[model samples]
Target: MEGRNLASINYNILDKSQQKLTIAGRLDMENISSLWPEIFKLIKKNKPKVLLLDASGVDYCDGAGIGLFLKLKEKQKENKGSLQIENLKPEFNQLMELFEPGQLSKPEQIPSFFKRVPEQIGKSLTISMREVYSQISFVGEVFVKFLYTLFHLGSLRWKDTFLIAEKSGANAVGITALLGFLIGVILAFQSAISMRKFGAEIYVADLVAIVLFRELGPLLTAFVLAARTGSAFAAEIGTMKINEEVDALTTMGLEPVRFLVIPRMLAAVVITPLLTMFNNLFGILGCILVMITMGFAPITLINEIQHATNLTDLFGGLAKTFVFGYLIAGIGCLCGLQTGKGASAVGDSATRAVVSSIIAIVVADGIFAVIYYFLGI
Candidate 1:
């Protein structure tokens, strides 16, 4: 057989029914494009019964070369022929070992829609169950630490608690106030527009006061805390965890739950109610501003607010703040503690912390609503 050199490949017709191809040089992205069509054309035109690929001359190869081998095997099989690869370089063999030729050669099986539905449901259910179990386990650990900290007050990290409180609560005052003010303005305007139709625009003050005192103030503050402080907690703890600082704490006989989590939890619990009060103040100020443009005096709006809301309404909302704070901080710390290893672990933990905190807050609010309804509060 006479061999013809075409670029890096030498093509030879071994017999009337057999063909041999020798591939050499670097089979990377730059070279593969030109070589692909040439080799494909040779296989199509010759339709060899037995195709031999001699790759010993190949000095370097990458993923593109692996793909070419797989495609050639498939093409040979389509022509009812056989492909044999011989004398491949050890390094090339090592790279090719990552892929299973048999798996790549076979067409991927796609499940029917009905089969896929059950598989999807199974995956979701398994993930949800694991999440629930993790939450329960973390909650138990937190509860134990909480009791221990309560009795052994000296063990509590007051310095860290105050520092966290300042960061999570004090520093967030501006954004929290702005959010409260906007919520109040929007609520007043929306309600005033509807109430004005009945010549009851003055009643917008009462509506704003009741809603802000009973719901929106605490809820909005908690949301801000979750988005801002909660995510930070997760990211910080996750970084420390992945860096093995948490393990070091254990080595020093310091409990991570007490040292890391308790401080944050305490800070959140203390600051949430305080922040809610600020939210209530700013929201009321916002309502007053809206009412002033609507031809109502500030005193008139204040009197109406006092008449519409009771201590119970104010206290009930504030109660929710404490729970919201606890949930936000606790869930954040839990997600951080559960962070997996990887470069992306810290980011993923932060995302999970925010999502989990928001969901827990909403669910807790719903439960509180149900409890209040039953108690006639």
Candidate 2:
């Protein structure tokens, strides 16, 4: 967030103890370095049983700052101590949501893996999966009616489709590019260390290209789209559900599933793979640029990149995007279709849709990973 806002963070300790330390101020981007020294100093001074980061006064915290909290948590845990972050604002709680793997929670909520296993396993996504298959199957019937409603090629729903496409693709231009670029840089940068040890640093280009094009591009693009357009689609449909428009369609002998769900599902099917392909291409650009900046020749980078990734991998990645697209749209629309008759229900459905789609995509990716790894595809 500091990078986004062109700002920084600086925190201080007001009171200290063998087991706790009261901290103050915002942990933004700029002043993080200054704050790090202070934290280490406290660690050196008392090696306290635990670090109680007093974020009671903290107004905001960015992603980078979350690392600081994690470090303190880890350090204390290593010594059989516990770290506690007190007085977190409600808004800050969302940032610590389980969107990513291994996010932290309140100190009291921490538990051993064995104790957590049953709870985690009990939270099955089977209900969500059933909803998706049923709703999306209903959508397929609607698509046929929709196609025949207008002309063979044109439909009244084209505007909605276009709007959705623009929202999902056009508006996402900057962020997608940024994500792709970052992915390329990260892939190559990490590979460079190992490649350099073997005196084959140029393979970093191949590493970046293959990884980005074959996996990261589609996964990241679909993930972001699920967060953006998937949520919006679910919210809009769910709102209509709560407002009785769905009921009105039923009364009028029209199916809400046909009119609403199918168009959204089709739009996602069309757009997600295109977005994923574009992501891989742009990420390759970033990879090439970064490699050249690191003193590799452009021609060498291109040659190596081409040789590294197979046509099968390229096509396989595109296929994964299609499956991911289906999962996101189906899950989102199903969630919307399930919305109860209340305004609050619409919001809850939207939030749940995004979260569920992401989880499904990630889980599906793991399944794909296992298939590819074992089958040697």
Candidate 3:
């Protein structure tokens, strides 16, 4: 080793392939400012494959000193060389550990849009396929657990089911009634305007009854459930997942689907149809008000409504509620169970639950319409 001593630091030419840098005295901003550029120049000139730093003689170090060490390591990295810090005191070693050289690496450049397009498509497709698979698997598990709960009624958590039902259904009564009433009033008023020209203004009752019973009432109720109840379920379950409570339950031999999901699903199934019926009642009340303003008696409007819609219409809409309720609850629970780590995970899960529930409800409603149409319901 050919060693040369500087004022407070030592430089050593160990070999052609390796170099040694010895740091000594107080390493602060003043010392580092001068030493930094000198070290960089030597490292650049030699481009040693391995650079060893001996910090045994380092009397003291501050933030600037720590920064200098980090910079030297970065320089070696650019030269495709390794830096080894040796003979550091425990405290200095601890300070060195606080900063990792990797953290200072230059960020990679973003690829061009054209270059990334195929990668983006492939990534999206892969994610979508995985999501579909997860949903299918969750559905199967829920179905199996539901069947088990059905056969063993005692296994269902009745208390939790009642609480969720109250929250999702009873607490939502005001908004549901208001929305349904407004919808009916709007539908009736619009229909009456068109029918008035033909001297058939009273047919507005028939139109309102048919549309609400066959389609809008249950669909709107499902939307409310998807937004309110489904989002809540997702947030609750996602929080539980994040806290590792779900894992704890699994460790304790409790099925998370059975314990957490079944109650919410049952609550949704029972409450959704009940809420739909309330929505229908309020909607009809709104229709009655509109018809009375048009000089039609309340009894007359009721008679027309009865004649316009039969049990098939009412029951068909209610049937869709059952399926909609199940899907909303199931999707919410599925999203919650799939929650990932990080600050935004719960919020993301809730959003996915609401969106997925709405999509599923619409798709299921369409399928139901087709089946009902073919069957002449």
Candidate 4:
């Protein structure tokens, strides 16, 4: 019964083939060795049909104690006799649960590749469908708020809208112009090489103008915005979401979508088309520079561009820019608003916003291209 003493084991022979082993005191590392000899001796000599281990008297047990029980259980199994544990403490029960053996000897059977492929595909489809539903619902809510703000002009946050426009549009002008100019220069250079073979280098001007105004201008502008402004939007809003500012706004009866999203959306819608137009102008400027270097007159280049491009081409590109802007802004806001909890969630949202916006822009551009082709524009 002394605290320093090892666990004491007492045996009670119940019958010819039945026996009980009572363990008392602590069964930890320092004390478990004392109980083993008696247990083994009884097992070897009597080889009882049933061994009942009464652990009620045990005050504490450790890993060693659990190992001892496992050894006893294994010996009982070898003798084809059952080992019945009695009066186990709740704490010991928990310990046993933690150390319990699983069926590791019997490995799990993996399904065949063909069987797994359809299952994976179905899971992917289900996830994709859920994401689509979430995005559509978010878009619908934003659209309703946008319309309401339009009708009630006072409700529109003009100051925030202007600030966002300035940041997303004005700050981006330099990069947009540079990219546009480079694209035009590259296109003209490539085209002029082929045109020169046929003594039709003048046609490079037409090619550059048509391509820049009808396709490259809008598409390039969208990609730039998606990478720059779209990611920023998501990060900014996602930070607010994590800080509980969005929830605080909600508690204060201010709709976060209306207050935060509407301004950014409007800014994108108004600024993207203007930026596209500017991109087109800069691209043409670059083409002119190239053509002048190639011994073509500036006036001649201007005339070619004027002749090759029309109102339809210009407006079609602008319309596509508008759609791309809306999608980029909307997707960014959606990703931000849907951000999960954690430090990495903001970065994840930003990345998702950029990727999703670019994808939406590309898909929307393709749809526009098909529609324009059908309409003969």
lDDT of each: 0.91, 0.75, 0.90, 0.91
Model 3 Cα shift for residue 208 (angstroms): 0.6
lDDT score for residue 298 of model 3: 95
Considering every candidate listed, which one attains the maximal TM-score? Answer: 1
The digit string of per-residue lDDT tens for model 2 on 1-377 reads 54443223334443454354554556676656667777766676666665566666666577656666767777787767677777767677566563333755656866789978876675556666776677666556655664565355454467876777777777887888888888887777788888889999888887777787678988999899889888888888888888888899899987776567666766787788888877887788888887888898888888888899888888878888878887887778778878887558988888988998999899988898898889787
Segments of candidate 2 deviating more than 4 angstroms: 1-156, 373-375
Q: 309 in model 1: Cα distance from truth in Å?
A: 0.8
lDDT digits (tens) for residues 1-377 of candidate 1: 21222239999999987899999877887789899999998888889999999998877777999889888888898999999999988877777777646754567788999999999999999999998998898899998888888899899999999999999999999999999999999999999989999999989989988899888998999999999999999999999999999999999999899999999998999999999999999999998999999889988888889898999999999999999999999989988988899999999999989998999899999999999899888
1 or 2, greater by lDDT? 1
**Residue 278 shift from truth in candidate 3, angstroms:** 0.3
Better of 2 and 3 by TM-score: 3
TM-score of each: 0.79, 0.60, 0.74, 0.70
lDDT of 1 at 191: 98
Per candidate, the number of residue pairs that clash is: 0, 5, 0, 0
lDDT of model 3, residue 189:
89
* Model 3 stretches astray by more than 4 angstroms: 1-104, 109-116
Model 3 is weakest, by summed lDDT over 10 consecutive residues, at: 1-10
Report each candidate's C-alpha RMSD, comma-separated, in the order given: 5.8, 19.5, 8.0, 8.4
Arrange candidates by lDDT, descending: 4, 1, 3, 2
